[model samples]
Target: MVEGDTFQKFMLDALEIRGEWVRLDDSFAELCQNKNYPESLRKLLAETTAASLLLTGTLKFEGRLSIHARGSGPVSLLMAEATHERAYRSIVNHKAEPFESDDLNHLLGKAQLAITIEPDKGQRYQGIVPLEASNMGDCLVQYFDMSEQLDTFFMFDSDANGCFGLMLQKLPDYRSIQDQDAWDRVTQLANTLSFEEVSGHDNETLTHRLYHEEQVSLFAQEPVRFQCTCSPERSLASLNALGHDEVLDILEHEAKVAIDCQFCGAHYEFDRADVNALFGLGKMH
Candidate 1:
């Protein structure tokens, strides 16, 4: 099996198109290990995670990019986030029974997909689109076409072993007659990619097989890992957000307050002294 948990960028020199490939093995396993998700939900979450990373690779920002979905189905909510540094986390909230179908529309029934780009120093940008396709790849392609006015192609796959994705996008300069022809040809070739080829082969072999006649430049691979941004201080800040009275009410009822990080399952506990310190008062015995 190919070593996973890395993102690599490549440029089709002759086609004026750029692309990215990502594979998640141990990182995917780590993210899913702690959660008790049905198989259908697991696959959807994995695809979302791969899509988030693929989109994040195209941006030159210092913040995070997130893909979110909400619907009126058994799977009510699904979310995935990837930072500029390539750290990622994902979650799925759904009803307990195993889904009988893996179709995106059936699993997500009447869902809306939201893509948000948050820069470290600027206002966040978001685009919303209805989940109109049978799969995530087609839905994202539709989003870019309608929202960004760019031609894009996406292929993604995930199973019990790992998850992987490939994306090809026509750059803005691809407008000439020759460029248009090249774009069409490259996208057609990209469309022929099978999940087996994407998840089973290494980057070099895969790209070469797909675009052997074109001049392709494979860039250095960036490492991607599973990481959660949860800490005691952050949890305390959340408690403060609920107001002093609310915190006291919870503490009075439970004797101690506990908060769990949804991403990594880390637990944060607060006793009376902890709550008092958060409110700028001296600790109580």
Candidate 2:
């Protein structure tokens, strides 16, 4: 088994193809332990978390990338986020009753997947794809095919302890017959991979097992951990968005204004003085 939560990149040196692998254990456990998440939700969140880390490997950015799944069923939200340095967090919002199935179609009926990227310096971007498939991996594959026009394949599996993902993409600027054939052959072999092999083994062992005949180069693994980016400063900034009059109006009744982060459950409170200081005014009457 992989030693810890990690994300890595790999290349089929001779096939003009590139791929990414991610496995999450401790980090995932920490993400789910605090909440009394049901078995089905934990499994889905695990895959989303792994998927988020895998997508971060494909982008060059200073900020963050997030996966947001929304639907009209009992479960309304499944969100996972990861930063450039691989810090990650995830959350789920659903009905009180436990879901009967873990399948995406049943849990999130008539849903859409959104991949949003917010670079620290550049313009923000988001891509959306309808959830036509029953699994997140294939939903992401659909996003790449329709929105990015990239030949990408994603596969995911999870057990009680860890979630695993493998992604293979055809490198750009390829129009040759050899490239097409190689892409087909590589993805077909990837399909043969099973949850037992993927969830229980390390990347090197998994890679050789699938592509033993081909020359594949595996890169060093980068660690991934759960880090919620919530703080008093950010919470204060949210209150700032409420504007001066609105803030005073809220203060008129309550002794303090309170905000709690849904992801980390961190709480921030602002009394009159704090609010007055925020707007650069004296004590409010």
Candidate 3:
């Protein structure tokens, strides 16, 4: 079957240059399907989702990468997380609005955008920057430069059709982006892409338009799909975290426990007998 959305990473080892391209379809649309988001917020969340997948694919750790936005604008908070295992989740907490300005002061209106990486074996890393980028791509590029000191360029697009994005970061020990001018040229070319084209074109076609002259090597693409991490065992563990007493109280009033997985909107229901079994009151049949 043809994959819906995918993110491809390309590297020029000789030049020590690396970049990525991403397309999101069902993997991102599933999130919006669960919630009726406003046009602006939906686009923002979709872009953030595509970006999380693209950025996290570059990490070497077995952990989670989280993108968070807290703003005073019409949309207050949006978050997306992706793990090394390829599992992802996204949430937006705000009413959808038709606000169309890309200005940081206008779109987010005095807010913070944070990129956090929690590794399985090392200390968690966090980079915080003012939401000044006219778009999410610019915000991430600013974060990479300010926090990791990497020369970075990012391009992102989203619409009712789908979401697409690209990221380029110069490796360490290289000259400045200004000195080489590659960053400026690539970004300028990237800006020429329209939402309709980015959302519709394939990776090869998009690359040809942006880097036709450059010797860009496109790697084999991987399939990206919407997968939820929720399970009965996991739901029981969450109930355990809420404490046995709380579970009993919920069972007493509601007569059953119900949990709606935020990512996939899957509902899990457990009765008193199930709760008892969960607490070791009875063995499995």
Candidate 4:
């Protein structure tokens, strides 16, 4: 069992196809460290984390890939984002509840999952897909087919301990559209992955299971990490967006304006002095 925060890509040379796999134990642990989340919520966070990683790996984008879902169920906003630099962050909003077992549809009742790709120098693209897939993997595959018009498969698995994901996509510039036989063969192999096997095994074993029959090459792994880009400076900038009067009013009632990052639960507290300096109300000391 391979254990770490790493991503691997495998390919079948003859088929002109490639697959990406990622295991995110350490990354997910970092996300859950400061937040008090129920087991279900934690698992969802891990699932989204893995999904984001695989999606970013598949799509060659310079800036960021964001997967967000909004639902009327117990959990509301669930999102995970991964950047080209390999940074990751995940968040889930749900009220206090006991540990419970639920499928994706249950946790995300009547929801929509949106995928947004923001490139560094181009216009952003966003795709909205219904929450029809009972699992995150199926939902993402549906997204690719609808949005990109490409046949894509995504397998995402997560538990309280860790998370893992696999993605298979037909090359955009493939030669033959009638070569259903090859696509069927690869997908059939992938379909053999059981929930038990995926949830229980690690990256290496899972890859071996899916592609043992094919001549596949595994690429050098890339490290995945949980990192929050939020900072006091950035938070202060947002406070400025609230305007100077609102900042003073916030300080009037409370000792300080505390802003907590939903992704990492990192708290940024701004006191009156900090506020004054932020608004240029104090001397440059």
Candidate 5:
């Protein structure tokens, strides 16, 4: 496996804090392939993908984590998902107009960001907040502050090569003013990191550079990859969800039912015979 698409977790042993670092290379490129997204939208999707993986790392169950953003501006919808096994995918819907601004709030006006967690054997949970900040990282920080009541810091970057992210969160053990100061110190040090540094440096070097003076324990790195969950069977199930009459109408008009997976651009076609089998009408002679 390539080291570029990797996720690593670490802890500041003495500071009662934990963090995660992720970098995406071939996986990121694969996710963006065949989709001619504008530069800004591409970056936004990449960052969302990275953020999804980071959140997935925090999960204690065997399931998936997803980040969804719906806005009323040029960018209408953006979604990213990552499973416990590290498979990930992302998609973005935007207008044809050129988005020249770098401000996220301007590009995605009045957006709502939602994070959803679906456990394998339990109920799903979701948290949603208004996208008020110019940066997604800051918006996520606000989410943790309000929902989790934990101080969290996030740094994310995307460029021609790949997308990268670093996250730090204070644990509940911080009871004294001294612990709070230590948490502030670590977060401030983390804030000093720039896009160039996060994008250019490896996890080991980045961690060492940021917290060399502190006793940090790094864990084994997990690999992340681009994998779309869409399949012909899944597409057929969706067509079934549209009800038999609607699908029959589509097939009657188009001669066949065609569906495209937005995440991977996979095309699935269901001819008359396939539709007959799907609806238990038997094969057409």
Candidate 6:
């Protein structure tokens, strides 16, 4: 009976600040059903998933956005992707350790975070988000500073099963000094909110609690779910990269070419007939 996964957009009507709120519950648990990740890593993955949703709402596009971070520390890689329509999926690659820290330098080491935007009909774009921040949301916030675009702020919280994220970006070029002052005051009020208020309560209650004096236009919530875009046809096309001869060689040693989807844990196997059909190698019997 939980209205588990949803993404909502809202506006501080009087302040010219646009914001988004996202919560992932059943869909989040479904995404992790196949993997056995430690609780800490699971929490990180949940945050990344929520971050991906919030970021996707920030941009106006017809494609998907991917949040990817990699490092040589206890955590090797974490990635999450969400499409424009709100369909999403996420995964993480990490060691099963608790990231024990005798020190900070050894725990998190050198890491890089990149956010990639791939449009459905146009060229793809990627930005490097600073990974030095203490958490995922702050790391993404540094991206706006580096670009010198809109002043963006993010608040994110998550546990092992679910996560929530809020993002607010100032509208370009305030019309008046009052509007400018309002932006500062509004962001200050927002920053004062605790993670529990931001993530635990619904958007309407949370927004009113923070900005009771301002007019808010709360939009309808959109559904977000776990969806993996893997198909056997796509997997078969990947074999083409290896060429016919190589695929035949792989079939020589093994019974069939096997492909396993890491995101959804779906298994795909290509036998001699499947290979022959793909490579135009007529009749491999």
Rank by lDDT (best first): 1, 5, 2, 4, 6, 3
Q: Could you tell me every candidate's TM-score relative to the true structure? A: 0.91, 0.91, 0.80, 0.85, 0.91, 0.87
Q: What is the RMSD of candidate 3?
A: 4.0
Comparing 2 and 3 by TM-score, which wins?
Answer: 2
Model 3 quality (TM-score): 0.80
Stretches of model 2 off by over 4 angstroms after superposition:
177-179, 243-246, 283-285
Give the least accurate 10-residue stretch of model 3, judged by summed lDDT. 173-182
Tens digits of per-residue lDDT, candidate 3, 80-152, equal: 8888766678877764666766454566778998899999889998889787667887788788878878878
* Residue 257, model 6: Cα distance from true site in angstroms: 1.1
Each model's lDDT = 0.87, 0.86, 0.76, 0.80, 0.86, 0.80
Off by over 4 Å in 6: 1-3, 101-108, 175-177, 198-200, 242-246, 276-280, 283-285
lDDT: which is higher, 1 or 5? 1
Task: Count clashes in each candidate, considering only residues at least 3 apart in sequence or on different chains.
Answer: 0, 0, 1, 0, 0, 0
For candidate 1, write residues 70-145 as lDDT tens digits: 8777888889999988899988888765698878888878989999999999999999979888888888999899
Better of 1 and 6 by lDDT: 1
Task: Report each candidate's C-alpha RMSD, comma-separated, in the order given.
Answer: 2.5, 2.4, 4.0, 3.1, 2.6, 3.1
Candidate 2, 88-146: lDDT as tens digits: 99988898766888789888878888999999999999998888888888888888888
Candidate 1 Cα outliers beyond 4 Å, as residue runs: 34-36, 276-285
Top candidate on lDDT is 1
Query: CA lDDT of 222 in candidate 5?
Result: 91
Return the lDDT, model 6, position 22: 87
Q: For residues 1-285, what per-residue lDDT tens digits would candidate 6 score against the true structure?
A: 134799999988767788888888888877777687766667778888888988888667799999887778887777899999999888888675676542223334587788899999899999996567777777777887776577788876676667777788887744543666787787788778776665557777887887789888989999998899889998999899889999999989999899998888899999999999998867556
Error of 4 at 70 (Å): 2.8
Whole-model alpha-carbon lDDT for candidate 6: 0.80
Measured with C-alpha atoms, the lDDT of residue 66 in candidate 1 is 93
